[model samples]
Target: MEVLKERFGQIGSQSVYSFTLKNDEEMEVTVINYGCIITRINVPDADGMIENIVLGHDTLDEYVNDPYFLGAVVGRVAGRIKGGSFELEGQSFTLAQNDNTNHLHGGLKGFGKVVWDAKVMEDGVLFSYLSRDGEEGYPGNLYIEVTYRLTNDNELSIHYRAQSDQKTLLTATNHSYFNLSGNLKRDVLNHSLHLKSSRVLELDKEFLPTGRIMEVNDTPFDFTKGGTVKRGAESDYPQNVLVGQGYDHPYILDKNHDHEIVLKDPESGRTLTVESDEPAVVVYSGNSLKAEGDFRGVPSRKYLGICLETQAYPDSIHHPNFPSMVLEKGEMYSSVTRYKFGIED
Candidate 1:
């Protein structure tokens, strides 16, 4: 096992650095302090061919100009908040309407656009950031820490911890777009996906949760038996069209299953299993992806990559029956999500 660090770039007066953590199994995970972004993950296929499995850019300039969030941590609140405002403790608060009429991904420069303090851990890296009370129109001076670790067992684990000085809404998640075919050889439409979820939070036309839970029994959202992602991406279902002809809904996780979620590439025999403590996982099929120039990923197009964002239900603060995302003042907030990589054959 080894950990190496190098200067990545500069964000204002802050110096950005990238840390690479390697395991004895030939797995390497590189993370940068800028937005606590995962820059790279090199792992092997069934044929012993090691390649990068996640979408990323070649330089910091592309990262700074990226609108997709790429492979960074998103949030004071990960998803969209209704109408860019919410009531908290009998007080009305308004946030930046970056995503048209709603506050999307913590108002323009969310956690994904900030520079975090980095520390090298024994087998990983710890990235910490402090969000001022009024930063992004949130009412809390919060200190958060996210740890990224690569275990010898070929698991890339992420753990989050935080505490706020005042009550606030918070549901953070890592937004890593993964294309398991490795080296971007093909799109994810053919990647087999099996999700241990039977219900998904319904979304309205504006892509906001409608406080309704929809079943996946006979719909394109169904992934219980495991199949190619093409069903949802290529389907013209109303729900699918509501979000650029693909999935962008949060599926309520069924913890009763042993493996919560599994994504496999049949051709390369590369597999990724996701397990999280969060109640739901927002699966985005890269529905609206497009890029101007070449980068570490493939030619920009829809269904090129997919994101398995593990977090609390979106707009949970607006729905009484949903799981609460409020982190009380001085109370510790902790969550964990693990992504294990391996070969099926």
Candidate 2:
């Protein structure tokens, strides 16, 4: 294993640094302190050729100006919070409404837009940030740490730890648009997706959870048995019509003792297995991703990549049946999500 650091750029007055971690399998991951964003991920394909499979910008300036979240760590809350207000312990707190009429991904300037204090490890990098109390209308001084590790076995592990001075809501996940074909120009619609989830959170027209948990057995949202992304997207189901573009709903994962989801690109023979302790995984098919700049010299387009974001259910604060997103004082919050990459035999 090897670790290398380079000056990425300056975000405001803060100097951003990029840390590169390479393992024996020739897999390399570069992460920048700014938003703890993953700048690149290089892995070998079927032909033994290594290429970056994750969507990312060429420079720090592009990332700063990008809105798609690209390859950054999403936080405070990973998904939508309806109305941008939630009552906690008799107090009603309202957050910044950044996504239409809802509060999306923490707030206007969430964790993804902030600089974190980074520490290089032998096989990974640890990023720490302190979210001040009342920042973005939250109710606590929260301390968060996110560690990205690349193991020799071709696994990228993301570990999160957080604590708040007061009761607050917290959920975090990595928003990495993956194109296993190693070609950003090619859409991921042809990729085979298998999710170990039997149900999904129903959403309204605005993309907020409708407080309904529907079964995926006979719906287009079903990926229990595995199928191509295009097959699901082309289904004439009502949910598909409501979502319009592709899979953006959060699937309720089955209780499994192994990885919850698998995505494979037959062209490159590359497979990605996602395992997480979280209760749900939001499979976003990059429906609205039309970035202005080039991604590694390739033009960015819609459906070119997909995001399997593992975290708590969206709007969990309002749904009592869903797993809680509350982080109380003196309690340690921890979660783990891993992505293992390999070529199918």
Q: What RMSD does model 2 have?
A: 1.2
Name the lDDT value of residue 124 in candidate 1: 94
Across 111-186, the per-residue lDDT of candidate 2 in tens digits comes to 9999999999999999999999998889999999999999999999999999998999999999999999885647
Candidate 2 residue spans exceeding 4 A from truth: none
Models 1 onward score TM values of: 0.98, 0.98
Provide the global lDDT of candidate 2 against the true structure.
0.89
Error of 1 at 314 (Å): 0.6
Tens digit of per-residue lDDT, candidate 1, span 79-197 = 99989999888998889899889998888898999999999988999999999998888999999999998899999999999999999989889999998888889889999999999
How high is the lDDT of residue 48 in model 2? Answer: 97
> Which run of 10 residues does model 2 get worst, by summed lDDT?
287-296
Best model per lDDT:
1
lDDT of the structure predicted as candidate 1: 0.91
